[model samples]
Target: MAQFYTAKQRVTTKQRITVTIEDLDPFGQGVARHQGKTIFVSGALPGEQAEITLTEDKRQFARAKVTRLLSSSPARVTPRCPHFNTCGGCQQQHVDVVLQQQSKAQALSRMLSKEAQRVVAVDEVIAGEPWGYRRRARLGLQWQNKSQQLRMGFRQEASNDLVDIQQCPILTPELEALITPLRQCLRELKAVKRLGHVELVQADNGPLMVLRHLDALHVDDREKLERFSHKHQLMMFLDDGSENLTALSNNQPFYQSHKLKLTFSPQDFIQVNDAVNQQMVARAIDWLDLQPDDRVLDLFCGMGNFTLPIGKVVQNAVGVEGVAALVRQAAYNADLNSLKNVSFFQHNLEEDVSRQPWAAQGFNKVLLDPARAGAAGVMTHVVKLAPQRVVYVSCNPTTLARDSQTLLLAGYQLERVAMLDMFPHTRHLESMVLFKKT
Candidate 1:
């Protein structure tokens, strides 16, 4: 079937309207009500008046971007990044950091309170330096055929287009200094057309680099990358979209959490904010109130971030991960730390875990740091395990609230919840929850 649009159905010019910003929503957009319809205004802050141009329209709500700010909020701050408006790397840089934390904490509390069918408030907020705290970043590459130039930066807001950036304010100082030189180096490569993206990480030892290439690099291009690595004195890894990563240096990158060093490959997952991560680990351990005779089980334990620390204080610590590679690395990290009481196991938490060898043992204290999807498949098993205490570290609050239902129904209490200001100047929020069977 074919359809044709009539004159009435033809595209019309954008609609602009004036509205008073009421509040900031979960995604950091300003909330406004216009003629009884909910309007989400971007680049607008609470307690501000603005003229907005509609970007999206629906029956119940509409999305708009501010064209003119007739008024501004007292909490508004000047954004540090020049690309902050166009780049999608961060969203809340224009808003005050303290207000950002307050808004997010309120939202998190409401979400958890509703999910748990009881009042749940954030007991504490773990925060650090609002800028230059990020230890990891991935910049995209867009190669221009006619100009033979490679534009390296983050993606544009809500688009695939790259926002060419000289430096990002959120990245650590070490990684930030390499951005211009890295862009220049990528443009110098003969295999620019095959370039994918570049990942930078600020390890405790030094900065690290990873280049994702669609195809194998030429001899000269590889040498050029080597020279760049040599000049910066950072470890370099070339990823060909596979498990086999080509390393240009023998040095391994490592980071510290709870005073334990965790060695990981460029492929492994590590927290982007080192300060918040360390504080978070300490808080979780403190909340658990670990006893010397107790045992702890860490779910979704990647490279033994929390598991290694738990091992030091408990009689035994068992770390479980779905990825075999991470499990192996977690075990190696424990061994490297000389923690003989710690063990790592690889098992899919989505499946029946009672049948697994690791689940046969009794774990009095359990800590699970699942990804954004949350531990839906393992919540029942976690409840069944009958752990006296559980510390859940989550990157997504909706999923955290969703999974907390099982714990609540199983007679566990939401003791303490903390909002982790892990990624400032962004809508992304991380949290730590303590559930104790008291």
Candidate 2:
């Protein structure tokens, strides 16, 4: 009972004070202050003065919602997309690109310092073409049969309700053109009740859509889909409970990349922005500085995006993934590219990987690209591998910070880190770090 006892604190509203944003928080909120306490403000940017209404006042930090921008920074720019505020797809579009990258780097450094008691240096920002870079998107569909109204888009910020989007400029022209027709296709279906959502995927030749249905499609509905697929030259997938290939429609996926050809299933997780993804892959491989005798290990390798390329430079490389389907695809990509030294396997990476055959082998370099949770479970195995260098790609700054601490404990020093503006006009920042075994 004594151990649970703590100091008594009373709650009271402090005098409202306006402050300029100094940085970005982990959740993409802006960091501001009043009277020595930090305030997390939504929709505010660094170096911008804003009037905010206090939502919650705590012992350390306060929560605020921006009421008005008193003075906008010169770095702020007008967002292109009309759904900027309504659609929850992106954040940080209001901030300039350079400042955005700087804020993200600071966030990474701060989180790492707290976790590891060391500062990580972030390299130059890797940016791409700001617009029309998204190759694929899974749009939400909600059709009101009685009202004859259809809403097809992502949900609004902090709400479950959908946003009606008539046009999307960020996607390829072919994909953007299908949004209207796809909606019409669902409306004309004989069994519209069975329809749930449509997955629009951009490919080499055209767009492929997989319709997820609650019930099986009727004969007329099937015919309508066939006709649409034929007329638009679209590859259509109908899934009642399972994926099915009803008609043989060939629509190749079109990828606009100079060096890398990335192929992925719409259902699979591929970086939505093609341009930035290519830049990221190129930068990672370039920083690795591979040699002929080098052997590399790619952890959380998704469809061999980085594995196959690393295999190109080194004597041999191995990719480990959790999903069998992706492992199979990665192997196929290696074979298709005629890359002799590359191999892939499927294993649950969250568990111990020491039992694997390659655990005993030594690699000159290693690359880790994990999900938002980051790669905490494999740090011990990574250290055991004892590569000369390690490159980590991360989505979440908090998890990245924690993992950096683990790497630091294993005798690696943060050499360089770079923020990639993969999801621009949004708060999400992609970062990469290189560590040298010290």
Candidate 3:
């Protein structure tokens, strides 16, 4: 007996067509029109012709992959990394960095302008060295049973698989040099099967590595890690998925920003680009037009990146953060810098802070750097606080545009907006804006 497949039970066939890419979107996808419908091609660039295969079809638009390139754009450059196509680390490797920044800036301007109901021009696009700027990275680790070896690198794109990267060009030279030796050490470990992931960071002091494991390590394996750390002159830590860390060495890990030395653990969050961050901090401080008598409030202030610097120039500064660990670290950082005028508080930003002790003292200037979700409800508080100047730093444009309406309605003019090329060769966009009371 034979079975016949019905239309509903059959898999949808892929549609292939040739189209001209007219524009590039913020996500690094190429925009094209085919048969009166918009098509998004992943690996295609603007002003290029290519045959594409439709992966997803919808009523208004479709997603596609480039099959063959009929023509290439002048801006196209050969990717430096061998795993650029397969590794999910970077998306715009094929395109030059300058063009990449231009496209993102245009998208940001259009979105911010549309949301503000007025033409908003990007004052400047803050960019730094295109490559070797990523000071921190997390390399995924997986042990292959059949092969009896360890695989290390970034995860594969659109799949659970991993790409064994030999060289990552985006990492700083110090960190990239440790990749081979680090992998070899882990592969030789007796507890390799329990290995989870390896985090690499290059601090100004030295390189630091964190090895996350699911089980305990044998004494011999621990000795090997210590020897490796000593030989490489880097700090190493072992994590069992907790705040407690077993140090393999005795040196503290710290980085310098705006001439301030801040100590952070291996698992703590810090900006990956050191140069851009320092420049951004200088620009933000200058944009506020700081005065001698201004009392400042810094919200979502992770590790006192801005508050400590602001405190040096202002009368008093208060930094508030949601994470207790970060708040403690920020306060420690303030003391380390000998900044007695600055203070830190651990409070959830979503809740009203009017009753808090820190809120009793009014703030004339404010700064907030929120995650991608973009600080909602906080804008209303800012309005009530009636700060003369407010600085909002954001990583997601969609949320920034939505939140801008709140401040605009509160009679705060969007003074200046600058796109920060924090992560080059990737689609991540970070920007900061200044809002002044009308």
Backbone clash count for every predicted candidate, in the order shown: 0, 9, 0
Model 2 lDDT on a 0 to 1 scale: 0.79
Candidate 3 lDDT over 65-156, as tens digits, reads 99999999998999999999999999999987888888888899999999898999889998889989999999999898999989999998
Q: Estimate each model's TM-score.
A: 0.96, 0.89, 0.97
Model 3, position 81: C-alpha lDDT score? 96
Error of 2 at 319 (Å): 0.7
Q: Which stretches of candidate 1 lie over 4 Å from their true place?
A: 1-13
lDDT for model 1, please. 0.91
**Lowest lDDT block of 10, candidate 2:** 251-260
Error of 3 at 210 (Å): 0.7
Of the two candidates 1 and 2, the one with more favorable TM-score, higher being better, is 1
Q: Candidate 2: which stretches are off by over 4 Å?
A: 1-17, 24-28, 114-118, 243-248, 251-263
lDDT of 1 at 327: 91
Cα lDDT of model 1 by residue, 1-438, tens digit: 999986766778999898999989757899999999999988889999999999999999999999999997999999999999889999999999988998899899999999887788899899999989999998999998887778899998779999889889899999999998888888888888888999899999999999999987899999999999999998999999987789999999998777788899888889899899889989988998999999899999988889999899999999999999899999889889999999999988888898888896888999999999999989998998899999999999989999999999999999999999999999998899999996
lDDT of 2 by residue, 402-431 (tens): 888778888888888888877766768678
Rank by TM-score (best first): 3, 1, 2
